[model samples]
Target: MDDVAKGQNLDDFLINLADGLSRAQSRLNRYPVMNAVGQQSMVYHIPRLEFELKLQMTAAETPASSGSGGRLPLQKKSRVQFLPVKASQHQSSSSATSIIKGVFVATPLDATVSQVRLSLSVEKKAARKAQVNVAVIAAPGRSVQGATVELNIDRELSERLNKTPLKPSTRLEQASLILNQESVASAGLIIANQEPEGQIIALIADLFGQTQTLLYRFEQG
Candidate 1:
C-alpha cells in the first residue's frame, strides 16, 4: 500500500507540472510575437557653405598739387574683403554688407541743400548688372547735415528697381549733394550674390557728390 500511494502521488505531481507548463505557454501565446525583418536604417543630408563680403569706404585725401598752388583734389578710398561665417540651414543664399564712413566739407554755395541721399549699383565687368536692391534710397532724409546712411541689396528688390526706368540725367543727379559744415557721416548696405564663384563690382554714391567702387572675388567651396 505504501508503494501504491507513492506511485499515485508521483503521477499527480507529474500531471500538475504538465498543467502548469500548458498554462504558461497559453499565456505566452496570447501576447504578440515580433520578428526582425531585414534590418534597415536611412538618413539624408545636404551640405552648404556660408560666407560674407564686407566693404569699407572712407575719404581719400589727395596731396596738394604744386601746380595748383597747394590745392588738393577730393578723392575717396574704398576696400572690400570676404569673411567666412558659420553654416546655417536657414540661410540658403550668400549676402554682402557695406559700411561707409566719411566727412563732408561745406562750401559757401551749399546753403540751399536741406537733404542727402545714397544709392548703390552692382556691376559685372564694366557693364551694369541688375541685382536686387533691398534698400535703395530714392529720398533718404531731409537733413543734409552729414550723417550715416544705409543701403541694402538682394535679388527681389533689384528686379523692381530695374523695371522702373530713369532718365540718364535723373540717374546722374541721384547722389548729388550740397556742401555742409558737418564732416562726419556714415552709411551701410546689404546685397545678395547668387553665383558661387565670380567677381562682383559695387558702385556706391552719396548726395554729398561722392562715388566709390568696390570689387570682390569669390571661389567655390
Candidate 2:
C-alpha cells in the first residue's frame, strides 16, 4: 500500500481501539458485580525500557598484620549504562525539527518521577545507513542465569509513525524509543550488580556503538 493509504488505515485502527476500550471501561465501572470482581481497573500506560549494566568495584585497606591499628578507611568505584528516549517528529523534507519530552517512569506513588531528555543536531555529514535494535537484559536483583530482555516499539506514545530501515536525507528527524515493557527489571549476574543507571548505558552502547564521542546532556525534573 502507498504511504497515504497506510497512514489512513493506522489512524482508523487507533481511533477504533481507543473507543472500544473506553466503552469496556465504562461498562465495567457501571456494573457493581464487575467492579467487585476487580474488572473496574483501567488500563494505564507506563514509559519504560529493558536495560542492564556490568559494574566493577574496588576497595583499599590497611595491612592485616599492622599492630599499630592505623586508620582503616576504605574506598569504592563504579561504572554505568544509559539509554534515553526523547519525543521527536520529522517534517516531510523540512529544515527544522520539533521534539516533545517523552515520559519514562510514571507511577502512582512517585507521580513526580524525574525524566531524562536529549537533543541532537544532525549535521549534513555523510553517514552510512544503519539499523539499530535496542534490547533489555533481565536482571532480577540476583544471580538467576539465563534471563531474557525484550523491546516494545509504541508508535502512538512517542509520536511519528513506525518505519523500518529509515532513510536519512538532508533533513534531521526525531527518533522514538523502542521500549521493552511497561516496567524493566534485571536478573542473573546483571541483577547482582544492582545498578539500574549503568545497565541503561550498556544497553545503549550495544545498540548505538561506542559513546566516547557521543554528545549527551542530562536534564532532571
Candidate 3:
C-alpha cells in the first residue's frame, strides 16, 4: 500500500483501537487482576508485529519485591521465546499476551529503577539501505547489558527480510538483541527502498533484580 492509503488505514484503525482500549481500561480499573504492573503491555501496530511487554502479579507471597499499587512480588524467572503465528490467528488479548509470554524476569523490591541513555546510530548504505548500530553507554565503573532491543519494520518488509536471511526476528516479528560491553548489535536493511520509518525499540536491563525499560520511537514519515 502507498503512504496515503496506509495513513488512512491507520487513522481508521485507531478509531476502533482507542474505543477498545478505553473499554479495556475500564475493565482493568474495575479488575486489577494478575499483572502487578503499571501497564501490562504497550502495543505497537506496524500492521501487527505484536510486541507485548506484560507485567503480571503473582500471589506467591514471598516478599514484596516488584509490584505496583501495593501488590506483592513474584519469584519467576525471565524467559525469551520466539513463536511464529499467522496474523489471521491472532484474535484476542489473551492470544496477544500469549505471544510474548515472559517479557520480564523477577526483580527485588529494593532494586532501583532508573533511565539511562544509550547510543543508536543509523548509517545510510544507499537510498534503500542502511546499517543500524546500537551502543549502550554506562558509568565507567558500572556494567550494562542490552537485554532486549525491539525494531519495528513494515510487516511485509519483515517477511521479505526473512526470505533473504536477515538477522533473527523477535517474537514481535522484528528484531531483538542481546548486547554486552564487548559486543554490539548491527544489521543492514532495505525496506523496499523506503527511507524507513522511525523504529520503536525497547532496551531492557534485567540484571541484579533490576529492570530498566526504555521506549523510544521515531518515524521519518
Please list the residue runs of candidate 1 whose C-alpha ends up more than 4 Å from where it truly belongs after superposition.
1-146, 150-193, 219-221
Task: Give lDDT tens digits, candidate 3, residues 60-102.
Answer: 2123245666565555533322233455554443333232331
lDDT of 2 at 186: 23
When summed lDDT is taken over every stretch of 10 residues in candidate 2, the lowest stretch is 209-218
For each candidate in the order shown, give its overall lDDT on alpha carbons: 0.31, 0.26, 0.39
The candidate that achieves the highest TM-score relative to the unseen native structure:
3
| Local accuracy of candidate 1 as per-residue lDDT tens digits, 51-129 | 2222322222333336554465544323222222344413223334343233222233355654333333332322222
**Candidate rank order under lDDT:** 3, 1, 2
Superposed model 3: Cα runs more than 4 Å off: 1-115, 154-174, 193-221
Query: Whose TM-score is higher: candidate 1's or candidate 2's?
Result: 1
Best by lDDT: 3
Model 3 poorest ten-residue lDDT run: 55-64
Candidate 1 lDDT score relative to the true structure: 0.31
Candidates by TM-score, descending order? 3, 1, 2
